[model samples]
Target: MIVKFFKNSGGGSANATMNYLLGKENDREGARLLSGDPELTKRLSDSLNFQNRYTVGVLSFEEVNLPDDDKRAIMESFESSLLAGLDKDQYNMTWIEHTDKERLELNFVIANVELTTGKRLQPYFDRVDRPLVENWKQVTNHEYGLTDPHDPDKAQAVKTLNRQNLPKEVQQLKAQI
Candidate 1:
């Protein structure tokens, strides 16, 4: 996965950081800082270690203060750099944003390259959010499985089944047989 990193400026959680990285610089100040500093750009790139990877593309958010013209220029530069360095046919691009709320949230955009026509591919989107870590322990330990007796053999059997390479449906078939 091509993981892009963006620092969040708003007082809000990492969600803001992620939103910024995805080119949604609705905030003005963050855009300005990101557009102006080459050092920052290089640092961001280095942090992500984008060199020689199948995942290609610009993975950062514009600082909020960047001028509109500069923001456009930076994006163009990033696009050019990515296109020049990687084969459009084989690789895909993605942007990842990190958020720190009561729950974790992830947003992803995937861009594919057309094989036959060699055109820039469009983006697909997905997102996920779940309660914080502590809540998970409470729910899993206290819920449906609680009243059920702990059977070590059954647990081992389940573990063995999981470790097998077969797909879930095939595993079910095997169990039935």
Candidate 2:
């Protein structure tokens, strides 16, 4: 399955960000907040007192995939997607998974923008996320076939079972059977 990502911008955003992600607040408490690092999350929030920071949001494909079940894989995939687009190296990040919502999603609180080259650190959807997601879809589809129900095309949806049942060697195998 594929994962989708997005971004947002704001200030004092950390307290609110942490609260939302970690489920400290009232309405927010119900979400899974799958990641646990309260100390690191607090540190990340503390790191962004003055400078700029962007909230990089991550959303899983409509259907959750196996990797989604692994915290390490999810974190790695999230970071990989983040780094592949931006050149920045030194930045603080904290992400929380939203499971109780309509769709499974993750909100990454990224701050402490300290890129050596001083380039922008905020993730641009088109420039960074799209290509990554598209490439993931292509590669995974190529290997797994795009028919997974979560795939954009619903490649193997039962509604199209006719295609799955088609015989590849009708003439050659009819008599042998």
Name model 1 segments beyond 4 Å from true. 1-63, 85-110, 115-177
lDDT tens digits, residue span 72-127, model 2: 55565656765665442455566666666555555565654554643445544566
In angstroms, the error of model 2 at 50 is 6.4
TM per candidate comes to 0.24, 0.53
Clashes of 2: 2
Question: What does candidate 1's lDDT look like per residue over 105-125, in tens digits?
Answer: 222222234335445433211
Clashes of each: 17, 2
Q: Which is the leading candidate under TM-score?
A: 2
Among all windows of ten consecutive residues in candidate 1, which has the lowest summed lDDT?
Answer: 124-133
